[model samples]
Target: MEKKELQYIHSFEEYVNEFINALIAYSPKLISAIFILIIGLYGIRLINRMVKKIMLKNEFDPTLSRFLASSLLWALRLLLFITVISRLGIESSSFVAILGAAGLAVGLSLQGSLSNFAGGVLIILFKPFRVGDSIEAQGVAGTVNEIQIFTTKLLTSNNQTIFIPNGILSNGIIINYSLQGVRRADLVFSLSYDTNIKTAKDIVMKVMTNHPKVLKNPLPAVSVKNLTDTSIVLAIQPWAKNADFSSMSSDILEQCKDAFDKAGVSIQPYTIEASK
Candidate 1:
């Protein structure tokens, strides 16, 4: 019984010694890991602040600045996390391989969204259109309400909200109507064929020239554009400030009606087409 007890105590002592040896071996790795984590978190915070300052100094859009700053910070943090794991006596090669494979799969799945994100970034950086600007893009015409990372929101003339993907907007032609400082309002007036064309043109041109919003430098255009079965069509192009376009249009149409009546120019009747 004494021999058996001594043998059991010796085994326990050996087990304790082995455990201590293992712990001592891993202590340095644990310290290194803790050090990496602390330093990495500090570095991430510092980098985030620096990026924000740079973005602000460059006058980047608020949304864009926030997005870039957050993305960069998180990316740095992720790298630091991986490094910490490596310092903890972990074999990171397999983990890195797994992450690479997962990333490729995710990238493929999100290809379209990524494209839109990239396009949106380009739009924000280049500034093709600003909020409240009237623009035509992706076959939609409206006032830009907001520019997001993946999409653009527009308020239509008819008060409809439209959402267009940034990829389509960036790839296609963007017609910024507000950039010109002024836009031409195209007006077509149809008069009875029996009425004199020169008289009709003169009446329309006179009305356009008298409008307060009509620009005088570029000169208003009034000419016969088309001859239909029942009437002669007169085209009137008037340049007005962008903000005054709607007002000018309403005023011009009302003034033209009065002018036509005074000039004895008989307006033609309209016909509706049936769609098949």
Candidate 2:
């Protein structure tokens, strides 16, 4: 028992000495790694903050700014981790090679995602439309609610939320109704063949001119669009701010009917169902 105890004590002393020697040899490298890690983390934060500020100053979307900053922060942290590992005298070349291979595999698997990311970048760089803008694109007409990294959300008139992938959105044609700041309501009014064209034109002009939403500067115009066997088509063009476009169009149509009736102007039996 005494002999075994002596052997155990000797083995413990050897272990302690070896451990002390290893610690002494690695202490400087460990300290250096820790210092580098601290400084690298701080530098990464500073860089991320600068990037966010620059994006904000450039009026970049909040969604894009945050996504980009977070992605960069994670990438810097990964690089710092690799650097610290390398500083500890560990062979990181194989690890780096493995990481590269993994990244390539991930890239291949996420090709569509990468395309979306690229498209999102393009969207942010080029301001085609903005949040709250009423746009018609991809067979979807709605107000833009949010622009995300991979998808854009739109709130429809009926209050349905839609998520459109950025990849397809960027590739397809976009119709921005609100970009022009004003929209023109083109309405065609049909009257009986025997109705007086002069009196009808005068009534439409007066109704459009009196409406508060219609722009007076452009001076609303009326033209004889078509002459069918049963009716005379009159085209009424009025410009209104986008926000008031739909309401103005509806109001103008209703008021035109009343004005025509009061003026004893005759309309086609089906003219009330005219399409705009």
Candidate 3:
């Protein structure tokens, strides 16, 4: 019994000595890993600051630059972590494999977000629309307030804010009303079938041409449109600056109504013909 006890204690002492030796052998590497980690952290910060300065010097877009900086920082940190692990004599291949698998799973889960980010990059690169532009997309018409990495913000006419995913926004139909600085208002007015068509058209044309907001360069004019059973359809086309389009439309209609009444031309409601 005494001999068996002595053997157990002797083995334990060997293990303890071996462990101490291993620790001693690993100390230099451990210290170097820590030192490299600290130095790498400082270097990362320095590189980040330099990159920010370059971006600013080049007048890069603020949101895109910030996002890029964050992505670069994380990527550098990951590389540093791998390097430190490799220096510690731990098998880095398995660690990297685990990280790759985890990254793939995370990427799969965030596919939609990734798509939005790609769309945002396209938008920022091409600049199809800018902030304050009036755009209609996905049946929503509003002024673009902010452009983000995953979504774009819009302010509607009623003051409601809409967050539209950039993925759909970039891929979908977008009508930018303010891009050309001018918009055409298709105004349809109905006149009594019996009234003289030429006279009524002349009156509308005179009113539109005289309006300050209406553009005469394209030449505002009235023309005969679809003829209904009860009335004649008159289409008044006017070009105006984007900011004045709404008010100009309203004013032209009101002023035309007064002009029509004074000229003794009868006005009637537009009637659609039934299908045969």
Instruction: Judging by TM-score against the true structure, name the best candidate.
Output: 2
lDDT of each: 0.84, 0.88, 0.88
Model 3: per-residue lDDT, tens digit, 40-90? 999999999999999999999776687789889999999999999999998
lDDT of 2: 0.88
lDDT of 2 at 2: 100
* Candidate structures ordered by lDDT, highest first: 2, 3, 1
Candidate 3 clashes: the total is 0
Taking the tens digit of each residue's C-alpha lDDT, what string does model 1 give over 1-276?
699999999999999999999999999999989988998898889889888998899998776687688779878988987899889867789889989999999999999998999888889888898888999987789999988888999999899999999998898999998987888888777888888877877887888888899999788898887888887877778888999888887788778879998888787757211110
> How good is model 2 by TM-score?
0.79
Clashes per model (N, Cα, C within 3 A): 0, 0, 0
| Model 3 lDDT on a 0 to 1 scale | 0.88
CA error at residue 178 for candidate 1, angstroms: 2.4
For model 3, name the residue pairs that clash. none
Judging by TM-score, tell me the better candidate of 2 and 3: 2
All candidates: CA RMSD (Å): 5.3, 3.8, 5.2
Any idea what lDDT model 1 has?
A: 0.84
What is the lDDT for 186 in model 2? 84
